[model samples]
Target: MKGFIIYFLLSSITGNPLMAFLGVIIIYSLIDRFYLGFLPDFTRIFRRNRQMKNSLKELQVNPQNASATFSIGILYFEKKKYEEALKYLEHPKLKDNETANFYYYMGMTLMKLKRSDEGKDYIMKALEVNPRIGYGLPYIALIDHEMEKYAPDRHIINDLEEKIEKFANTENLYKLGRLYKKLGNKEKAKNLFSKAMVEYSYCPKGIRRIHRKWAILSRVYKIV
Candidate 1:
């Protein structure tokens, strides 16, 4: 309603409906980027690419540095260029330094590329390195992949519950709450959403800032 009013006023003043609509979109997008956190950041791709270039420069100075190569891979992954991400992540130098994150990222990228068997292996390796790695994201990804294959509802619920019980955080709690909502478990969803807010409050300031959007969404979902 507010957006329509703004659009109408802009069109009435400018006498150009298309230009006014575009203006409204730009204005709304800018506001959302800075304050609302509801819209995707369209400029993120350019910024990530710039970081990737800097990482490439680092490689020029030290050809054997896996850190630069890994950084470039992570940047590509952030931009959803999974194939390119896989290329750099799979670089021979990176193998010698395979941490839990390395395995998880490689596995997740492979899953995105439709290589599930190989992906699962790497994800399992990530778990072997650290079960609590990535705040339970590796386990959640496995569950998510299972869901894609029509895993039973009980199976998914068990998996999500186990992960949450092991380590509840804003990301997984809100995500599970959304899944519960989708499954028509309104009471369970609301409880999880409310718990997400409670858990968020206890997080360190830096982590809370990172997950602020999830906390806000949890509040909205709990109320609705």
Candidate 2:
């Protein structure tokens, strides 16, 4: 009702119903972008493409532009063009420098390519270089990998729990609970699920949209 009223007011002011509807859409999208975050970032897609093209042009001129190469490769990775991403990401020895981000992106791209072994190696290297990288997402990715193999070790689970305790967030806590549930540790799972909800409760309103799904899901899982 509120949105409809706003739309009606906009239409009346503009004297163009189509323009008013577009304005409403833009307003809603901006709200989601800044406060809700439930919607995907359409602007990022456009920015990635433009940056990729600019980087490609720079590489065409210099051919040894390490910065441009990495930029293009990461952009390709973001675009889900893994094969192409790998080509550029690995083309240079990164001037023989092994940065954490390069390791992580390579691992992720390899994982997407279905080369799990190589991907896991790269991801582990990334974690070894910086345990706190990607806000503990590297640990989450490994947990997911272990799940795929149906052989998640208790050590891995405990390590994730420790890291998650230090960097508690709804996404990581919920995933940790999921890991416990997968291993038949119902009590542990419930504890983690409850923690997830606690973390969500303290989350800032502007960023709550990022965690809302996991918060609601954790509530459902907590009771079960």
Off by over 4 Å in 2: 174-194, 204-224
Per-residue lDDT tens digits for candidate 2, residues 34-63, read 665667788878888888889889988999
Query: How well does each candidate superpose onto the true structure, as a TM-score?
Result: 0.69, 0.77
Q: List pairs with backbone clashes in candidate 1.
A: none
Off by over 4 Å in 1: 11-19, 60-62, 145-160, 177-224
> Scored by Cα lDDT, where does model 1 land?
0.83
Ten-residue stretch with the least lDDT total in model 2: 157-166
